[model samples]
Target: MHELTNETQGARYSPTSIRATWDGTGSVKDASRALGFSRAKGYDLVRRGEFPCRVLRIGRSTRVVTASLLRVLESGEPEYSGGHTGHCTS
Candidate 1:
């Protein structure tokens, strides 16, 4: 995971530029960047079942499949209105 800093606030955040790879593997950090989401918000999306990306669990680790994430981004599906607390905000 990479830590990006907000220039003005000087607070460290994650990168927001999502670069798709040919191998179809994605990191949570990258996905968060692509979606303009905070790390906590990204995990919240997963818990709310709003993220369409497929996750692979290994032990206590989770991995997202890049292709699936890209598909969701391109599908024009409903926005993730299931707010961070698992309540639908739409």
Candidate 2:
């Protein structure tokens, strides 16, 4: 499992790890975990259209795009930055 860095309070998911672990898409919960957030929060973000990555709605299930997630992880910026600088302040 990946751990959150104390300095950023964010979990870092390498492209290799993501590619190896997921196929084309993954659950919002998993994406949230990779982004260092809770499952509930992930759902909330999806509902609010503010998740860091592209989301696909298939019937009643929601899937986060693996490639989008990887891009966000690599860029360290959510789809909605909301003035956030992708840094944690002490």
TM-score of each: 0.53, 0.72
Question: For candidate 2, lDDT tens digit of each residue in 1-90?
Answer: 234355333323456777887999999988898888899999998887688888778778989889888888889977642234652323
Best by TM-score: 2
Each prediction's RMSD over C-alphas, in Å, is: 8.7, 9.4
Weakest ten-residue segment in model 1 by summed lDDT: 8-17
Error of 2 at 52 (Å): 0.9
lDDT of 1 at 74: 68
Q: Once model 2 is optimally superposed onto the true structure by TM-score, how far is the C-alpha of residue 88 displaced, in angstroms?
A: 34
Residue 18 miss distance in model 2 (angstroms): 1.1
Q: Identify the candidate with maximal lDDT.
A: 2
Give the least accurate 10-residue stretch of model 2, judged by summed lDDT: 81-90
In terms of TM-score, how similar is model 1 to the real structure? Answer: 0.53
Show model 2 residue runs off by greater than 4 Å.
Answer: 1-13, 80-90
